[model samples]
Each structure stands twice: as C-alpha cells, then as structure tokens.
Target: MAAVETKALNGVKLKKKEHRNAYATMMYMGTPRDYEFYVATRVLIKSLVKLQVDADLVVIASLDVPLRWVRALEEEDGAKVVRVENINPYTGQQKRFKLTLNKLYAWSLVDYERVVMLDADNLFLQKTDVLFQCGQFCAVFINPCIFHTGLFVLQPSQEVFKDMIHSLETGKENPDGADQGFIGAYFPDLLDQPIFHPPLNGSNLDGQYRLPLGYQMDASYYYLRLRWRVPCGPNSVITFPGALWLKPWYWWSWPVLPLGIEWHETRRQTVGYAAEMPVVIIQSIIFLGIIVMTHVARPAISKLYYKNSDKTTSMMQTAIKFIEIWSILAAYVVPFAIIPRTIHPLVGWGLYFLGSIALSSVAINSFMLPAIQVFVPLIGIFGSLLVMAYPWYNNGVVRALAVFGYAFCYAPVAWGSVVKLLARLHVSVEREQFFPKLTESSPPSGVNKLC
Candidate 1:
C-alpha cells in the first residue's frame, strides 16, 4: 500500500509526467440531447484541459438511449467523452444515471487515478485546479456529505468498487432511498484510505458547505460529527446541479431532461403500451391533487397563514411553499411507478393525468404556477389535517379539495396515468426551462439555457 501510494503521488505534481497519473472527472451524456447540456459541461472541461494538455480526463456519460448520442458527443468541441450504460442490477432499470454515477465512479469507470464526478447540469463558472490536491485513494468534498449519489472527485481503484458494493450489502439503508445513505454509513471515514480531502470544497449544486481546515473533512464528517461546526471561508467552487433523477417537466418534476424521452422510447420497445397504463393511473391522481392544492387550497389560505392581507402575493407564495411538499412527494412516487400496475382502465385515467399537467398552465396560483399540483397531494393525511385546522383556509381552498377529491376518488389508478402521459410526452429538461409539449417542432422562445 505504501509503495502504491508513493507511485501514485509521484505523478500528481506534474500535469504531463512521462508516467502521468490519471485525474478524471465523471458525467454521463445521451443522444438527441440538449446542446446546452454538453455546452455547460464544456465550460468545466475547457478549464481542466486548459490546466494541461495531458490532464488525463474525460466526461463519463451514461448511454440508455437507442438514439446513438456518441457521435454527437464526439462532435462537441473540446471534450473527451466516454459512454457508459447504467444497468441497474436489482431493478433492471437501465435509465437511472442519477442513481448510478457514484457506482460508476467507485468502479473506476475512467482511467485516471483521480476522478472528479461532476453533474453535467452544473456550470464551471471559475477555475478549480484545487481538486487535484487529494492524490489517490479518494478526492471529494464532504459537505452535507453523503455520497450525494451524484457527483464527486475520486481516487479510483478496485478498492472503491469493492468497498462501495460492500457498504450497500452491510450498510443500513432506507431501502427506499439509494446508495447515498450507504455511502457515508459504511465508509464513515475513508473505506481504507490514508487521507481524503475536506468537504470545504463544497457539495451539491446548492453550494452547501461548512467549517475550516486542520480538522477539515467532507460533510460526511459533519454528518458523523452530528452537526459539528468547523471553519471554512469562501473560495469553494460553486456547484449547482439538478436536484432529482428526472427533470421537473417530465411528470417527474426533476427536470425535463432528454433521458425521460429515452425512457419513454425504451418502454415502448420492451412491452409497448401494455406495460405503461399503470404508470398513467398513478400519475393522474398525483397531478389532480397538485392542481387543486396549489391553485385552490393554498392561495385561499395564504393571507390567513401569514396574518397579513397586505400581501395577496405573499399568500400565493405561502400557498406555493406549502404545495412544494407535494411536488417533492410526487417526485418520490413517480420513478417507482415505472413498473406496470394492473389498473382496470388505463386509458381514461391517463387522460385525467394529462388534464392535470395541461391545466398546470393556469397561473391562478402565481407566476410559478401549479404550486398545489404537487404539494397537497404529496402530503399524506397526517399533515393535511394540520393545514386544514388553520382558520385562514377559505372557500376557494375548500372547493379545490372538493373538486380534486371527486376527480381522484380512484387516486391509485389516476396516479398511474400521470406517470404514463409524462412518459409519452417526450419531455425534456435543461436547466429550469420545462416545455410541457414534448414534440413541439419549434423550440420555446427565450427558454434557451447556458451550460
């Protein structure tokens, strides 16, 4: 181990040593993709390549689409692309890049000794040569430090793969979450590493970081430290990424990313319409509940919640805030809905699901629109009663629930529909722009995004 460490360290100081140590950054890509997606990653790649011609780096994008996007990635200027397929061993779900990035990194999918796993959705706003400090074993920021299950820097070796796989088997996970819980739980400190970088570099797209050095560790330590406070001034890299597996517009609220379109295509291939109807039923209930709660319930009670009539907008905003819980819930539910259910009538419920999304255009809630579409329904009855007890809720809110309740009487079936329709829409998410209509020939005006 000492000899191996010495050899790896010898190559780190120079950019292009004769025996150059590899330093890789990871991300996945797909075909018929948003040009903006690669465009954004290019910003980071350009910075890394500028640091050295022989930086020993490439963007690791996953391939789950039938539309070969490899050529498109090759066509991109100033990028070295490696395509990976995220084959979910347990579920056999191939379209799960978000859940599998860390697995890829831990598996040493790239050649470099140091691998930085970055989300393609993030922009490299500034230079970040600092990530090179953690030589081998592992290199990553630990703020809010769980594996994040998305992005990081790694000292790739067979050991990481073994440890990660081991953690999953031995580490106690939520069963519902993903590899994230296991990442920190098992590794606690480095799996068997000598020195891992401090999380002060930052973690997640939200730019959440904490404390200073000497005792600097990633958020994993902080999490382990049980909210331990340390010192860290600015100078950390700013990393903003998509918050969830799917983009928001794709009936999944994650982002309207191109992968969902690919998911839709593959579903068609495997079982055709036969397997998709259940998803439609589930989606319809989720959507109907969202529309009624944000549009109807919260707006009606916002003034009361805040005890300030002067701000109807405030009421709208509060309504939206309360509804955010539902959106978050619906997000949690839909991905699991990809499995087929046996709904009596998949067709009608599917239409109801579409109606909720289409009606999501109504801005009665606020400029953000469709606040309740996700918020109210996502919450179960336990919390709903608390919100209802507040006296501020009025008729509009009550009426909205009444209407939603009637429509979603058979919510299980309706929920499947919502998932099915969004799956069919060819939905795509890039940054914050979500165009509801997936197949529109013309792109949305002013919805263009920067990487």
Candidate 2:
C-alpha cells in the first residue's frame, strides 16, 4: 500500500510538470496581413524552441485561421494550437484589429500554471523562461507610464477569463477597443507596481508586477544607438510597436529597420521559405519569356504601327498617348498585384523589380523610345520607396513630412520625363520609321480600310 501511494504521488507530480507553463501567441483571420503574421508567428515559436526555453509553445488561434496553418504550427513548428471563437466586444473597431480581442483566450488556458503571451512581432534574442516566475500578471512598461501588452506574463485562470468576458459584455471602457486597451483597463494598477525580479530559487510569485524594459525593448531604441543598451534586465526580446508596414517580416522593412534582417535570418534557419519559392520561380520564368518575346518580335511589332494622314491622326495620337501612360502605370502596379502576398521581403522586391523591367521592355520596344527616358518612372518609384523607408525619423509625423517633401521635390522631374516622352513620340510619328512607310503597291490593311 505504501509503494502504491508513492507511485501515485509521482504520477501526479509528472502531470503537474507537463503543464507548468507555456509561451503563447494568438492568431486570427480577416486581414491581408494574416499570412504575414502566420509566418512571423512561426518564426517566433521556432526561435523560442531554438533557445530551448523550459515551457510549452502554444498558439491560441481563432476558428477562421486555416487548418493547414494550425497543422504547420503544431507539426512543423512544434506548438500546441488551441482553436477559439473570435471575440469582438468592440463592434465599431477598425476591421484590421477587430479580432485581436481573441488574445483574451490566453487566460482561459487553465492547463498551464503560467503563460507568457506574445505578439508575433516579437524578436526573441535569448531564453525568457524566467518570465514564468513572474506574478499573476507582469508586463514591460516600454512607454514611460503605460505598460505594453506586446509581451506580457500571465497566470492562466478560468475565473479571471470568465470575469474578463463578463466585463467585455458589460462594455468596459477601452480607449483603443483592442486587446491592448482592454487589458490595460483590466489591470489598471500595473503602472505603479514594482518591477519583477525572478526569485533566485525558481519559485513563482503571485500578484501583478511590471517587467523591465529589457524584456520588451522597442526596436526604435536601436535607431538611436544602433545597438541595445537596456541596463536593467536581460535584453531578451525586441518588439516593433510602430507603423504596421514597417514590421520586420516585410522585405522592404530591412535596411530601413536593420533589425528586420535578424528576423529573416531566424526564419531562414527555421522555416526555410519552401512555400513561396515555386511561385517566385514560375514568375521569374514568365517574366523572362516576356522580355525575350518582346525583344525578338520587335520588328513584327513595329510593322503593325501604321502612318495616318487623315483628320483621325489626332485621335490616333491621343489614343497612343493614353496607351503609353497606362502601360507605364501597369508596369508598376501589376508586379505588386501578382506576387504572393506572404513571400519573403527580399524575394518579393526582386520579383517586383524584374516584373517592372520586363513590362517596361514591351513599352520601350513598341514605341521605339529611349530606354533611359522610359525607365524614369521606375527610378522615381525606387527613390520614393527609399525616402519613405528612411529609419532615422524621430516620429511618424516627421516621416510623413519627409515623404511629402520628397514628392514635392520630385514632381517636376516626373513631369519633365512625361514631357520628354511625348516629344519623342511626336518626333517618331513624323519620322515614319515607327509608323511604317506604306509603299504604293501595298494594299490598305484592315486598320487603314476602317479609317
């Protein structure tokens, strides 16, 4: 009987250890950013696993999140996925963040003693297992007064979860109507709490405490020193809380936010970009075919251009000019539309540049235009992207102002390019080379007959 009792006690202890803690993030569907966040979340989970943190990885995903994504999270990335219904306490909230309240489901995970809830934007630099030892609630105060919810520690409790749901139903006063605002209101006193310092003996603490800024180092801090210098606690994680478009997962965000490269490096080591490579390769092949065809068939294309001496010549010129302008616009827009939305930033930009060049070739070859004159729009676009992504701006307002300033300066240059192209088109029309010269023996073609 004594031996049996001891065995039973050991089994109970094992069960408790199995569910001691978890590092969790939430996912939902609706926005175009869904796939991007999925990729980011996978990287975050894999990074934690790479650190070999002493916790289970969990993803609190909404029902709308695709089944394949959930399976990948569980099988490929080694995370436990819990499907939940999306909570929308703030119906009037913007559609982008409408489902973010699903994060509240973290409190419902009573199987775990503690959970370190994270945003997918987090870049883990080191093991953060010590966060589990924090109290009932702990969060980094990245802002001077308000704690950021991007990375926070919480003890799972069904009672607390129920109370939160009730508060949401009761219409709690949430300034932003998203999880951050709601959670902030829920734990109003976190601002005044003492900073958490894990017990040396590995025992857990109980009440709310503030986590040091080191745990949630804002990426903007690196812009100042180009390195981290949070002297208080372990600089374990980095969070991007600024403009949504500048998130590290985006290819364009790198070099601008140099930290983005680090995120992609982690992704490369883990996920390996297998999903989007085929599409990229196929796109490259098609664009190459387009370039080759346009160049090889330039003579045939030139033959189709005909000189018009009648009054309709003005209308023909107007139509040709419209086509020229539209072609230029499409050259820029089509690449962005066709590329896979969730592709790695580097590949996405590469494909965009290639597509632009190939499409521009058609216009350049068809019109017999100067190559440099035709590519001015592409150069201007590249310049605009650089101006918008300049990272050293002190604030968003300054960034906006800088972009506006660039547009103000470049408007005249763009106009000059258009003017030059039109003048060249007029010269080509008069020369009769682009508009093929009609010999007296040649019969009128269908276009000429119609005119």
* lDDT for each residue of candidate 1 in 83-164, tens digit (9 for 90 to 100): 4444232332233333442344434442454555655433232344444444442433345444443445555565656455
Off by over 4 Å in 2: 1-19, 197-235, 313-316, 380-415, 425-451
TM-score of 1: 0.37
| Whole-model lDDT, model 1 | 0.39
TM-score for all predictions? 0.37, 0.76
On lDDT, the candidate that comes out on top is 2
Stretch of 10 with least lDDT, candidate 1:
223-232
Candidate 2 global lDDT: 0.73
lDDT of 2 at 125: 73
lDDT tens per residue, model 2, 308-337: 452346667667767877887788889888
**Alpha carbon deviation, residue 56, candidate 1 (Å):** 3.3
